[model samples]
Target: MPRARVVINREFCKGCALCTYACPRGILVISRDFNSRGYYPVMVTDEEQCAGCGFCAQVCPDVAIAVYRE
Candidate 1:
């Protein structure tokens, strides 16, 4: 099975947490670190757990999440 790699654009993220809720694998989380705009960004906690479902990217309002399968 192919694995997924998740990338989050910190500059574009607004800390909305929508992607966190959208991830079925529960690999995404809100980071403790802040972005350039002082907003917390979403991060992938475990890449191995990702299923490449692309749910996080689809639900992101800011289009900050990207998922690549390998």
Candidate 2:
């Protein structure tokens, strides 16, 4: 299986948690650091575990996540 890389545009994230819930691998998490918008952004806990399913990107209303398979 190809490894996945998940990138979250922290500046655009709104702390919605939709991506976290959408991730089947449970690799997405809300970070403690706040972006310029004062919102907690999502982070990929383990890119190696990602399935590249794009569920997070699909559910993100802000369109902040990008998933790539390698």
Candidate 3:
């Protein structure tokens, strides 16, 4: 299956976890595993559910989320 293009910049992410809350489709979440900064990393659990609304990107104060439309 083709996947929706979504990218998260872990380095730029301050682990605010706002993306997980902003996603209407419940596609984004905070990882149990920590990133380099010891903050829980955010991720997309289901890409197909993503409507490409860019809510995550918009809510991210750190500009950590990027979504690509296919």
Candidate 4:
């Protein structure tokens, strides 16, 4: 299986948890660090666990997540 990489646009994110909930691999988590907008962004805990399913990106209302398969 190809490896998956998730890129999050922290500046565009609004600290929503939809992506985190939609990730089947449980790799996405809300980070303690805030972005320039003062909103906590989501981070990938384990990129190796990602399945390249794009569920997180699909559910993200902010369109802040970009998933790539490698």
**lDDT per model, in order?**
0.90, 0.91, 0.82, 0.90
TM-score of each: 0.93, 0.94, 0.86, 0.93
Tens digits of per-residue lDDT, candidate 2, 1-70, equal 5487888899999999998888898989999999998999999888878889999999999999888986
Question: What is the RMSD of candidate 3?
Answer: 1.4
Off by over 4 Å in 4: none
List of clashing residue pairs for candidate 3:
none
For lDDT, candidate 1 versus 3, the one ahead is 1
Better of 3 and 4 by TM-score: 4
* Candidate 3 colliding pairs, count: 0
lDDT of candidate model 2 versus the reference: 0.91
- In the order shown, the candidates' Cα RMSDs to the true structure are 1.7, 1.7, 1.4, 1.7
Worst 10 residues of 3 by lDDT: 1-10
Tens digit of per-residue lDDT, candidate 4, span 1-70: 4398899999999888898888888888999999998999999998888989999999999999998996
Candidate 2 wrongly placed segments (more than 4 Å): none
Q: How big is the RMSD of model 4?
A: 1.7
Residue 62 local lDDT, model 2: 99
Sort by lDDT, top down from the best: 2, 4, 1, 3
